[model samples]
Target: MRPQKIEEQEMLNGFAKLFKEKGYEGTSLAELAVVTGLKKASLYHRFPKGKEEMAKAVLLSINEWVEKHVFNTLTNPSLSPEERLKNGLQSIQKLYDDGNTPCLLQAFSVQSGIEVFHQLINDSMSDWVDAFTNIGLAFDLSQSAAKEKATQVLIAIQGSLIVSRGFNNPNIFINSLTNIEAMYTQE
Candidate 1:
């Protein structure tokens, strides 16, 4: 794969952070330009499709991040299931600590032109589900049960992020993790 130019990667990272802080409708091209240290024309030059293009880029970047960090941690061969869950929760905690930003998938889902963004979201989410399901299977769960648990974990995570941000408390995510661990233990 060809490496992205530093400027292009910088702009995409800035867009990802901003879009996480502010939903698609709330982010303006001018704000993106300011955050990226690029003129509006320059941003448009890099992303001809404008804000939508930037939003797509931001979502893709974060999806890749989640796959690498969170999902990979859960599936790491060196970590036991309990350790994997702990490491995964720690990864999430770091994300919250870094910036109490909203979930990009949920943020984009509610936007006006989100239909254009669904494919990326769906693919990323499916991959996440698969990751968790594989972990569950490794722990001796049946395939169906594993996938169901994965869905539950995903839903709990999404809800935890929304509620945690809404309540201005990061513990909601930790609490959700506890509940999920309990569920797994009961199985």
Candidate 2:
């Protein structure tokens, strides 16, 4: 019940960064403690189920972030489809730190991590597709076309992230976003 040294979001960010770098199987309690500036006891106090629980919390936090920043922007009734796409892509850029950060979803999809967090990962990805599909609908694409474009958009994003990191070029990611915009906006 006492005040903690680290704020909750800060603590989760610490955990998320480590997980994104190392994956759930690779991260350890000691490393998490060091990253978060918390003792093992404090971490346990917050996550009684231990590392798996922490990973689940990190995944949930990421889903919430995507929902708010990406999904909401794309679906906002107040914005034009163009405006929504622009803002949503901006949020995506920030989410990945302009391609400097690896995706937590990718990091957590390694064999062991997938085994434990499959449902959460699957649902997050489906939600992403649904959001993009909705945006495509706003652009007057048919439902099937919108869904196809949505799948392609997700592929572009995930593939570009890997290529950008591999080539040490953030522009790959930036260009992918541009291409995605064109996909929906261009005839």
Candidate 3:
């Protein structure tokens, strides 16, 4: 991984936070420029395609972070399935507690108002589902069962994020996880 210049990293992080909080449609180029402490012209100099380019860059940054942090931890060979799931849930909860923001991917999908953004959203979601399915398979779930469970877990997570955001309660996410666990144990 190449090290980003501090200014570039700051821009990416600012965009990620803004995108998470405001969604794609709600955030404007001027607002993004202000958040990054750059003039609109300077922002454009760094991201020539303008807001769309910045959005894509923000998504890519978040995607890479998720893969390196959450996905990698969930798929670590030394962890048990329960341990992995718990850690994943905890990581998500921490994100909510820190910012009270919705999932960046979901926010972008709902607010981008562009067909290509929809395709990008689908691709990102598929990657997440595939990762969850791989983790389930490591726990001896059959392929179909793993996929199904992975889908359920993803749904639960997204739902929990919505609920947590609305209610301002991070524990709602843990409660949702309890429900997911119950589904797994129930005959």
Candidate 4:
């Protein structure tokens, strides 16, 4: 049998998707209640601190995913830097749904949980950048140069997602990944 926390995490994952789409300010307790199949009282019981707490939980889970599945791709010892970065880019692709999805961090950046949201976003992004930097280091790039490349990769991924979403075009997003790969191979 699954533990209760597993069930809770499953519910939280559901909430994460809703919050990703609607954001902290836009998503309501009523919506959460409906989506989670719980009453307001039940939600309060599970998440005693209310909506802020729920958003924190969701963001933390996302951070954990970044730490686990995403970063691990960069750290995998068997893969070359190119392969690791390519895998990481694929993870980024899936995370943003080929640019069709909204960023959960962008969603949480507004509304009631701004402080926690921003801090978690910073922590999560720093880890992502760090992973990219590590991949560059594997290719003997200097720390500063690697950091810059990492930032560029992140910017490309995020910017592509935003633009592609705005224009309803995923090809730009795909091309952005290709460009990053070529950039890496060129370096």
Top model number, TM-score = 2
Q: Relative to the unseen true structure, what is the C-alpha lDDT of residue 89 in candidate 4, on a scale of 0 to 100?
A: 80
lDDT of 3 by residue, 35-87 (tens): 87778888877888888899998888877877777788778878887777667
Off by over 4 Å in 4: 1-6, 111-113
Error (Å) of candidate 2 at residue 171 is: 1.3
The residue ranges of model 3 lying beyond 4 angstroms of the native Cα positions read 1-6, 178-187
Model 2, 142-161: lDDT tens digits are: 99999999999999999999
Model 4: colliding residue pairs: none
Candidate 4 global lDDT: 0.83
RMSD in angstroms between candidate 3 and the native structure over all alpha carbons: 3.3
Clashing residue pairs in candidate 1 (N, C-alpha, C atoms within 3 angstroms): none
lDDT of 3 at 45: 77
Q: Would you list the C-alpha lDDT of every candidate in the order shown?
A: 0.79, 0.91, 0.78, 0.83
Candidate 2 vs candidate 3, lDDT winner: 2
User: Weakest 10 consecutive residues, lDDT, candidate 1?
Assistant: 92-101
Task: Write down the RMSD of candidate 2 (Cα, Å).
Answer: 1.1
TM-score-based ranking? 2, 4, 1, 3
The per-prediction tally of clashing pairs is 0, 0, 0, 0
Using all chains and alpha carbons, the TM-scores for the candidates as numbered come to 0.87, 0.96, 0.86, 0.90
Ranking by lDDT: 2, 4, 1, 3
Cα error, candidate 1, residue 63 (Å):
1.5
